[model samples]
Target chain A: MQWEIVIGLETHVQLSTRSKIFSGASIAFGAEPNTQACEIDVALPGVLPVLNARAVEKAVRFGLAVDATVNRRSVFARKNYFYPDLPKGYQISQYEIPIVERGSLEIVLGERSKTVRLTRAHLEEDAGKSLHEDFHGMSGIDLNRAGTPLLEIVSEPDLRSAAEAVAYGKTLHALVRWLDICDGNMQEGSFRMDANVSVRPAGTTDFGTRCEIKNLNSFRFLERAIEYEARRQIDVLEEGGTIRQETRLYDPQRDETRTMRSKEDAHDYRYFPDPDLLPLEIGADSLHSIAQSMPELPGAMRNRFVATFGLTPYDASLLTTSREFAHYYESACAGLSGTTPKLVANWMTGALAARLNESGCDITQSKVAPEQLRALIGRVADGTLSGAMAREVFEALWAGEGEVDAIIERRGLRQISDSSELDRLTDQVLAQNAAQVADYRAGKAKAFNALVGQVMKVSKGKANPQQVSEILRRKLALPGYFLPGA
Target chain B: MALAIDDVRRVAQLARLRIEDAQAAPMLAELNTILHLIGEMQAVDTSGVEPMSHPRDVAQRLRADEITEPDRRAALLALAPRAEAGLYLVPKVIE
Candidate 1:
């Protein structure tokens, strides 16, 4: 019997607030251990926790982006546990009700888009890091990350395959960055994921026991861990064994998972409302302002591109993946209305992307401003320059040589579109190449192309190929050729 | 409504604390006193009163999102009993 994989993700997005969640300490990564950790972050006595309004605004911004209902009021609770990294002996987090509730995101893989339901996104404080290396039989604590604000986004068990999980991850990564809430930097542990994976027999509605795979720091690990855990569960179930619910760690070196601990069912985290913080209540004015301040979401922008700009859904999605690129494209397309948007989209995704990669810079850092690119696109859109020549002008602009019109004029690369001038060039080529013209009359398409090339060469490659081909064909069929209609 | 002595010992174990046998009864009694007072308050008919998470009328005193602390690693780590390489060392903990 086939097995179905059920996967859910709990992603911790470290909000990019300038300070710690409840303290005025820096959360900058790569700081020395305990250097940025203030007294409150270190859990000193008599130090009380306070909320950061910027962190709250970021959470609200994310909620609006996902179309989730932003709970006007939410409560902070203490999650009690005994870990060396947790100096306070309990983590301040939301329990009974989260700030954001019941949102869904559309994850598109190629042409198929799937919607994943989110259970909730709660606000919480991060714990410090435990350093085991070079400690000689002891572990060290780096409280730099302690008390950092994190928005723990939990998704429903809706993903079916490893590929879908990865796509969803990438989409979520882009969305957070687009919202400017989280930097979505995986290398710095700013964004982390824990996947719960299980496998049940196909066509069954009953759920199977899931093992939580913790701390997948990278997207590749997220995909591999979920895949490996699913297969492992299926193997055990097939061998007449029951799957045990436990927490496992993904060892990337071996590409396998081992039991971290055989969890004794549930650790009753005695949760109670944190008496230090009052209930967080948002007003309608706050919600309205946040909603009004939100930039156009990717989905809305994608539809607008398709409807207004006449772009394919594929091109629209690609351009709107990042806010910077989307803004760049819009700025380039500004004031150039009724022009072919696909021209801009094609160059942005195709030639411009290749150039940006070659220069090893992002769109923001690239010297090629949107206006410069727009000028180049305009040359190609009209009959001023050929596509290949337009590329050369782009390179010149990238090298800070000159503007588009000046480069075209200085290099003498303008297309010869005057029919009368192209007619003279075409007639001169036909008269000089009588044998090839006879071959063209003999129904040789190659000879016809040769005549067009000859015209272009005779005009010193200034004549437009389309115009030359048209005038050449019209001239050949007039009366001096072998046959007009035969 | 009284807390048992065993309950106190269980909580102590969960908290990674080793309470002496003589201390367990007093801790249990102390916890029971608080519970008894709560039980007495539960008898009062204050159905319309809204539960407050904090006694203060304010939600939370929010601080500006700016880093105001400087590095005090050497001084703070000196407070710990063990230290190495700018890290506060503790007993080896794998889990």
Candidate 2:
């Protein structure tokens, strides 16, 4: 029997504001256990919440970027529950009306793109942490992360496979970083993904029951968890068994999903409007102001790269993964004369990217500046330096030795392209390798490359490779050349 | 709906409150009285009335985005029932 997987993601993105959502405590991570917890965050008596305006601004900016309906007035509600980590005994969140609704993100699958519709994006507060390790059998509660702001984005069940779901997750991550709303860091728990996975028989319309897999923080985990859960559901149905609706946790060590709780044991969160905060309102003037200040979105930038710079679809997508990287690429090629984008992109993605990954530094933190790289690119384009020699000079530039020209001169790595000088070297190379010279005249194409290698090696790699190939073709084909050791 | 004896007992468990059997009947009676009053109010709803979250129509008061609070971990830890190593100690919680 054939089965189809259905997936919808609920992503919790922590906004990058300085303060908590409803308190003035610093939202810095890795402080002392409860140092960042203020009175309101810890739920002290007589303490009331004061909504952070900056968090609301972030949501509005995201809404504008996605072309969503930014609700002018939205209410905050208390999701009542009891847990040790929940200091307030209830989480202040949005229930009936969310801040942003009906947004869509574009995901590229293979060579085609599709739009994933969002149900809503709501503003909520993060709970504290419960530390069970090193407790001597007693758990400890750290309220430092309490009251941190989160924008919960729920998507429509439009995805059909694990690959599609992860692609959607990646696109969303890039969009959040592009909008400057979230840092999109999974290790720090800033951006987390939860997937609702179910399987139904192919060519059927009725929906099957779904069990949610919780807190998949990385893209690999997201894909693996969805694939495991969908297969689990299909196996149960194929064996004439029923799948229980529940919440499951993915064990990275085991690479399997385990049942955390049954649906019958789900908490009944008696939700009601939070009376402390009034309904949030965004004025039309403010919406217009934010819309005017919006940066070029990733989708727009990717299309422009393809159209303007003639980049491949894959290269354009990769270059626009982050705003900082995209800006670096633009600056490296910006206002440079006589250079093609193909050359600039090849260097950025190949050489510079490899170096950055090796040093564990971001492109923004690179020692080689944009204009410095542009100068390196310029020399390579005009044949002032061989590709091999250019790489040596680039290392010098990255190490802060000197400018491109100075580094090239200091290392004596300039390409030798004088035709008279290359003619003398070519004569010595063809005489030494009579086999390759005879083979070249006998129409063996690869023999010509062996002759060029000899000329470059004899010149100590100072000879221009193009000039060696060109001069070798002229000397080996003099009309009366004799073949030896053929 | 009115609260029965069992309903009140379950609510007590969820709230982590321990009520003796002797107090269960009176607790049920008092909670039912409050519910009966709430039921009476629910009977009369003017269809056009907007649900009010607060008694007065006022905007929420917002605070500036500046750090005005200092780290008072030692002072606050002094008020905990049991604390060690800058953490609030509680019973070991398992999900």
Candidate 3:
């Protein structure tokens, strides 16, 4: 029997706040082990936890962006657990009360769009890091990351395949970055995902045992880990073995997952409201104020690019994926109004993107300014330069800090659109290639291509090929040459 | 509302505790007491009430899109239990 994979993702997004979630300690990464640890972070006796107002607002912004219901009041609960990284013994997280709930994100996979609904987005303080070395035979702990605020966004098990999970991840990545809530840096562990995967028979209603894969930071790893886990689970069931529900770690080097521990139900955490802090309450006025300040998200921006600029959906999506690229493209089309949008989009997607990728720089860091890019496109539009010469001019402008007009003048890359000049070159070519010209007179239609090549060679590719061809045919029919259909 | 013995052992294993078979009975009894107390929370009837994820009503703060500093390799390695040169020291598994 065929099996279906049911996958859910719980992503921990480290809020982009400067200070710790519940304390005034610096929330900087790669700091001294115990230096950033405050009394609240270390869970010192009699120390109270104060919520960061900014962190709450960030969660609210996410709720509004996802069109989720924001809780006017929620309670903080202490999740009782004992680990070396968790100094508090009980991690202060939301249990029954969470900030945002019942939201959905639309992800485009291949040609179809899928809506991945969010279970909830809860706020919790992060634990410290545990260092285990092979030779030391001992473990060490760093408390710098302790008390760091994390917004754990949990998704429903609506994803079917690894590709769908990856598409959902990318959509979330873009949303958080666009909203400026989280930095969404996978390398920094600020944005991380824990995926729960299980397989049930294709037509069966009963769900199979699930495994949770932890600490998948990159999208490639997320896809690979899920694919590996789903297959592993299916193989286990096919072999007449019962699959165990457990938490697993993805060994990226080996490209396999191993059991870390058994999965926990909510009753296991012994969750209770923390007596140290009061329940969080927000007014409608505050939510409205934050909603007003949100910038145009990626989805709306992509729609605008297609509708306003008349660009293809693919081109618009590609350009609007990065905010900097979209801003640069818009700035390039500031002065020109008509069809400049399509022209600018082409240059950005083609030459500009190629150069940026080759040099390993972002659009903002590239030396080519929007105005200069517009100038190069203007040359192509007005026919002062052929499409071929405009590319060379773009390269010159990109490599050097020279204006488009200056590069055009210095390289003498102007197109020869003048019919008179082209005619002279064509006639000179006819005189020089006498054998080919006689062959053309003797009704060899292919001989005319050789004459056009000679004109281009003489003009050093500066002559317009179209104008040269037109002038060549006109000159060939002027006298005793038998120019058929000329 | 008390937790069953199987539930207590499951929770212990989830938390990575190596509880012996003999210790399971008493631990199960203690866990039942705690679960009974926590069960009081369910009695509050939070049917339509939203769950609180954080404390305050403020949004998340942001930083400028700029690389501020280099990775402090030496300082970070100092926290590791074992380190040699710039890399963390681990056991050699391969021959």
**lDDT: the better of candidates 1 and 2:** 2
Whole-model lDDT, candidate 3?
Answer: 0.82
TM-score (0 to 1) of chain B, per candidate?
0.78, 0.84, 0.62
User: What interface Cα RMSD is found for model 2?
Assistant: 1.4
- Candidate 1: residue A241 Cα off by (Å): 4.4
The residue-by-residue lDDT of candidate 3 on B16-93, one tens digit each, is: 788898999999888777778788877887888755544654433333322222434456566556655344444442
Q: Local error of candidate 3 at A297, Å?
A: 1.4
List each candidate's DockQ score: 0.61, 0.58, 0.11
Query: Model 3, A65: alpha-carbon shift in Å?
Result: 1.2
Expressed as tens digits, the lDDT of each residue in A53-155 for candidate 3 is 8889899999988888999877789998767677678898997889898888887664466778999999999988766655456455667788888999999
Q: Report, for every candidate in turn, its global Cα lDDT versus the true structure.
A: 0.87, 0.88, 0.82
For candidate 3 chain A, which ten residues in a row score worst on lDDT? A477-486
Best-performing candidate as measured by TM-score: 2
Query: Which is the winner by DockQ between candidate 1 and candidate 3?
Result: 1
Question: Candidate 2, which segments miss by more than 4 Å at Cα?
Answer: A134-136, A202-206, A337-339, A441-443, A471-479, B1-55
Full candidate order by TM-score, most accurate first: 2, 1, 3
The residue ranges of model 3 lying beyond 4 angstroms of the native Cα positions read A1-5, A109-112, A134-136, A199-208, A234-242, A263-267, A426-456, A466-486, B1-95
